[model samples]
Target chain A: MHYFIELFFSGLTRGAIYALIALGYTMVYGIIGLINFAHGEIYMIGAFTSYIVASVLSLYGYPLFATVIIAGAAAVVWSGAYGYTVERLAYRPLRRAPRLSPLISAIGMSILLQNYVFLAQTSDFISFPKLIPDLPFMDRYADYLGSSDVVILFTTLIVMGILTFIIRYTRIGKAMRATAQDSTMAMLVGINVNRVISATFVIGSGLAAIGGMLIAAHIGQINYYIGFLAGIKAFTAAVLGGIGSIPGAVLGSLVLGLTESFATGYVSSDYEDVFAFTLLVLILIFRPSGLLGKKESQKV
Target chain B: MLKLQNLRAGYGNIIAVDDVSLEVGQGEIVSLIGANGAGKSTVLMTISGVVSCLAGRVLLDDVEIQGLEPDQIVRRGVCQVPEGRHIFPQLTVRENLDMGAFLRRDKKGIRDDIDYVFTLFPILAERRNQDGGTLSGGQQQMLAMSRALMARPSLLLLDEPSMGLAPLMSKQIFKIIKRINADHGTTIFLVEQNANQALHIAHRGYVLENGRIVLAGSGEALLTDPEVQKAYLGI
Candidate 1:
């Protein structure tokens, strides 16, 4: 029972990271129907931003909480600006072009960002400092849970709660839902579809930044290429959960995380990727609309 | 209240509306009648800034609104109930109505407008919480019109409000359009394929053919015109 609980906590932490990344994928896809392949690179940028902020602020000898807060906030702002610029430069112009144009452009952007960061930051892995301090009571169950795990879970829950409130009750949220349904109609009814699309990218990228910062702090290391694998896994999670559904993305990430944890725990750790890929294929074959996706009929 | 002069607009190289000119006076309902592909809908779309005008001017109360963004056009009190009743399917009926007033900031006025919409279509009030997609065709049309009215526009551009409706429901819709114009003094520019019913209610009418206005006259004069009877009324 204790072993399983330990696995559950670990799985939850990993799932939280995947969920944050997957939401960026799902939201950009939802509003504009683009895969936003560059989303993973945005995550990488976040980690880099946080790392730079931490290094610069480390000179001040601030406490762990203050360092994490300042670093995380800087990462969010920088990453969000990157997201907005990416949309305006790469995605916005291709909006009216053939749908394939934007997909190709997104792939190009992913490559561009990866190379740009590699050239500027070097290809070597950078070690990250622990952002969360060890709490006194957590030492009692150190084998089962860590203070970092608690922090990740707490942040994820708070973000999810705040996002839910905004999406459900706010005016901008209603406009977003409306645009997702029918953008042409949304415009006719006076909603600025462009502004809504930009807002979605901003929020999604900010969430990804937080996820990047947390994952880097927890793992204690990051590389320019870390976003590639994380992006693929989160993309898989988004597809597993219904591609456009917010709750579905989180649920899919949890499922993916638990599957990975158990497989690594009981089976050969070398087969982790194989297990995840096989599960994705099986799910696609059995349930093409994903776990929670409703089969939508196109109105001709 | 609304004027389009020599408006030329279309989709990528294919002109849907070619040099069409028209006008709607305040407190009057003007109908633009045509067959499918005659540019009636395109004219409305251009005026509402959904489609760009290639070469011409769209003026709303002497203000050049051509080339303005769609939301900007709506802010200037030119609202369009687009073809096919393009209501947001996932949102509730009440939510759909609220979105119509997206630009307005007056909370009391918005509340009053919503109440007015409900009075216009009581079925909407009853189904305020239901998703717009769940409504039947005629009910959806009502919701679409009500949603547009939520903006409280001085000039309303209605495109094919009677399309895909039963004869009875279409008649009811026409009756409501007349009531809205009479009671509120809204300047209306209506586009419809159902020429007979449209002309019967309109104060003046324009006949569009092949992306141009082929004829224009008072509603009674057009109804009695020999060419109109032969081509549109199917006499």
Candidate 2:
């Protein structure tokens, strides 16, 4: 029973991270119908940003709490800048081009960003500073849930709540939803569609940056290539839940995280990816539109 | 208060609105009537700045607006309800109306306008919380117009407002169009393939043929003209 609880908490922590990253993919896809392949790089950049800031702040003798806050804020802002620039430079010019063209541009951007990061930051993995400290109350539950896991889960919940509120009631959120539904009509109603697209990129990048910071702190390591695998996994989660649906992304991530955890716990860690992918294939075969995706309906 | 001078625009290599010039005075209902391929929509789209104007001037009260972005043009008090009543499928009717007022910052005025549109189209009021896609065709038309009205536009460009609607619904829509104009004192630029009804309600009407304005006259004159009667009114 204890062992099962441990795996479950671990899976929940992983799901929280995946949900944060998957939201970026789903939101960008919802607005533009384009898979922002470079989104993962944004996450990597975020982790690196946090790493550098945290290291510098600590070196300057800043308190741990202040250091963590400053590091996380820096990560979000820098990642947002990168996200905005990526869209302006890579996707905006090809907005009217064939759908395949923007898609190709996205893949090219992903590769370019990865290489850029590699050249700028050494490929060697560096140990990340523990930004989350142990809680006094968590000492009793430490066997099942670590302090970092608790913080991650709690932060994700708060972020999700804030995001839901923004999308449901805020003016910019309504504009985003409107643009996603029918961009032409959105324009007719006086929405700056380009600005909305840029906002989407920035928001998605910011979320991924939070995920990057949390996961890097949890794992205690960072590298330029970390985003590649994490990005693919989060994308898989997005697709599994339903690419354009926000709630679907969260549900998909949880399912993916739990599956990986249980499969590793029961069978073997070596086949963890195999189980995760096989589940995705089965779900796709049965529901091509994904679990929560709306069926494609054409109006005559 | 809108004027177009030799407006030439279209897709790449194909001119949809070729050398079309017209004026819609403030508070007048001007209908541009034509057949399926006559470029009526292109004219309105160009004025709304959706399509790039290849060559020509689009002046709103003497201010050139041809090269501005679509949203910027809308910000200048011109709003369009394009063909097909493109309602946001997932948005509720009320939310759709909110989108119509996207640029407006006056919260109380927006609220009053929302109430005003609900009174104008009571059916929309009842379906306020329902997703727009689930509405009937006639209801969707009502929602689209109400959405446009939320902008409180000085000049409302309507493209094929009667298209794909039943005769009874079309009549209701036309009646509401006139009411909107009379109530708000708004200038209207209406584009339609349904010539008989458009001409009847219009103060002045222009006949477009193959991307060019072939004729212009008062509503009664065009309605009774021999050439217009033969080609357009199905007389």
List TM-score per model, in order: 0.98, 0.98
Candidate that scores best on lDDT: 2
lDDT of each residue in A1-300, candidate 1, tens digit only? 888899999989999999999999998888898999999999999999999999888888987778988999999999999999999999999888989999999999999999999999989999988777788888989999898999899999999998888888898888888888888888887888899999999889999999999999899999999889999999999989989888889999999988998888888789988877887898899887788777868898
What docking tier does model 1 reach? high
Give one digit per residue, the lDDT tens place, for model 2 in B1-235.
Answer: 9999999999878899899999999999999999998998889888988889999899999999998999999999999999999999999998899899999999999999999998888988889999999999899999999899999999999999999999999998999899999998999999998999999999999999999999999999999999999998889
lDDT digits (tens) for residues A71-169 of candidate 2: 999999999999999999999999988899989998999999999999998899999999999999999999999999999999999999989998889
Q: What is the C-alpha RMSD of each candidate to the true structure, in Å?
A: 1.2, 1.2
Q: Could you tell me the TM-score of candidate 1?
A: 0.98
Error of 2 at A152 (Å): 0.9
Q: What TM-score should be assigned to candidate 2? A: 0.98
